[model samples]
Target chain A: MRALRLYLVQRVTAAIMAPLVFLHLGLILYAVQGGLSAGEILSRTQGSFFWAFIYGLFVLCASFHVSIGLTNILQEWTSLKRIAAANIAHTFGMGVMILGFRAVYAVVF
Target chain B: MTTTHKVSIWRGGAEGDYAHYDVPARESQTVLDVVTYVQRHLDPTLTYRFACRVGMCGSCAMTVNGVPRWTCRTHVSKVTGGGELKIGPLANMPVIKDLACDMTEFFEKWQKAQSRFIPTKTRKNPMEPIKPDTPARVAANAGIECINCGVCYAACDTVRWNADYLGPAALNRAWTLANDERDGGWADRLKAVSDHGGCHSCRSHQSCEAHCPNQLNPAASIAGLKRLSTSAYLKGELK
Candidate 1:
């Protein structure tokens, strides 16, 4: 049952990440080629609810995607069993979320 | 002139190592030839399995140089480099003896995956004619030539990772039934294959398609199952 859940989660996260990744890439290209400074970018993005939400969702999807892939890799290559692999995956996802949320808070607030 | 080729054949069960033997190589010689020569001349006790020396029987399959291949048609020139060959039993299976793995689990998973076709009509009733060019029939025909060689099953990584995951051949067989126009239990079969260790478990690695002796594409069949399962899930047909 847990395996099923992980499989479904991976699929759902991949779906979400598809558009988020494109949007993120577009924004980076726009900002870098347009020669926008860090302060200028912050001024436009600072405390914006839309930017916060988009980046937050992006971070969440990325964390889920990376952790699930890493869990499978560990299971295949390392000595970790399913239970230990799940624990490690959850820890990695939580750490990414915490760090991501901190960035969102610093930029938006 | 009789030419000798150095062959290293696996000599025991699961825990065994490769044992080297020099055998006579000939024109159009095959990997099975090497094994047969070693067993017949060098050691009568050496064991392996083969029926038809041709590729039709699908009985003579083993890992030749880290790849699953039909031993009957796989010529020595195609596999051997520097006149050396390393033969072993198929992977992802328990070897019962030298070059022969126990295939009970392999075939049992076919049953578990419900690979058999379920009939919708009795023989006493009128016969139903199925159109050959219909979409379902065409899809079924695309992957129905599998001969149960166990090569794809041995080469699959998903089967190695999740023992319960139905290997490519069984799942491919299920895909054929899923597209059968005469079969009536597609809903049940789809649900059965949509479980944790079912069609969704396939990682789309394409190893089965790569190693299939008949050159059939089981990976595409698996993708078809995923599409069917997703549509079924949306329609509330799958729990």
Candidate 2:
């Protein structure tokens, strides 16, 4: 893929993640301040598809965002290029998505 | 002003040490003057490069006090800290000798950016009339005066980190050509600069703009390239 396309992808994912990260942080604050117990948190999030969807999208965007940003960093710091760089970035993205989705599933179910 | 000043200069290629020399300081003296004094009086074997002894040629650039500058224009008083100076070749490049860096990569990047203007018409056709006041022409005019001094390239942290990155000089030249309305090479030029180590690699650190002797803003040019690439991609014009 062209670097322009990758640049766009990274920026788009960052844009998507920014608001989601803030909202998630706000939710954490709310939950802690409300003295919500583990049971209460579970009860609130277990069946809520809305929270699941938001977290899922967050995970997906963050995965792509981090991988792409790290790939750029690797290119700058090291001599990694072409297929090697792309493959490492893609592998990182896949790992993050898988781990994040599993965590989301554990929380939502 | 001191009658003599301590000057530490890099004395070897690739791997070397700073050799100290006492140079006679004079009124209205440039840094190049001090280097010349060392080579002429103290060390006959000291190697350096300069031409025209004026700012127009851009051949006398070197690191003065850890900052890349036109040595012919930089005065000893301005750069001397505590009665000492450290002069060396430009950073982010292979040092060919004392105070001279290899410009092969710098020129290579310019070629890779494909910065030459491609005329759309043959000589038989009428000359194209370009309005100087147009926004594109004005933007092009603003960045077109670069003499390839390599100061910006030396000052760039991106170039320090990424060897493949097309430094500010090449990208600035590319921006000028990209804005040329009569140039027929936009598609290929745009594609060339949109690749890895190209315009997208710029972090907008502004070091290039800050250190440029001509005061040209390469960060702005790279931004223009980014905007152009985005627009070209959206419009299906980029190949």
Best by TM-score: 1
Q: Model 1: which docking level applies?
A: acceptable
Cα lDDT tens digits, model 2, A18-106, are: 89989989999988886979897888789899999999999999888888887877777778875677689879989999999998998
TM-score, candidate 1, first chain = 0.89
lDDT by residue (tens digit), candidate 2, B192-211? 88988889989999999999
DockQ of candidate 1 is 0.43
TM-score of chain A of 2: 0.90
Report the lDDT of model 2 for residue B140. Answer: 96
lDDT tens digits, residue span A1-109, model 1: 3454566778898999899889989988888886878787788679899999998997898788878878886776677886798789879988998899898888888
List RMSD in Å for every model shown: 1.9, 2.1
CAPRI band for model 2: medium
Candidate number achieving the greatest DockQ relative to the actual structure: 2
Local accuracy by lDDT, each model: 0.86, 0.89
The candidate maximizing lDDT is 2
Give per-model TM-scores.
Answer: 0.93, 0.92
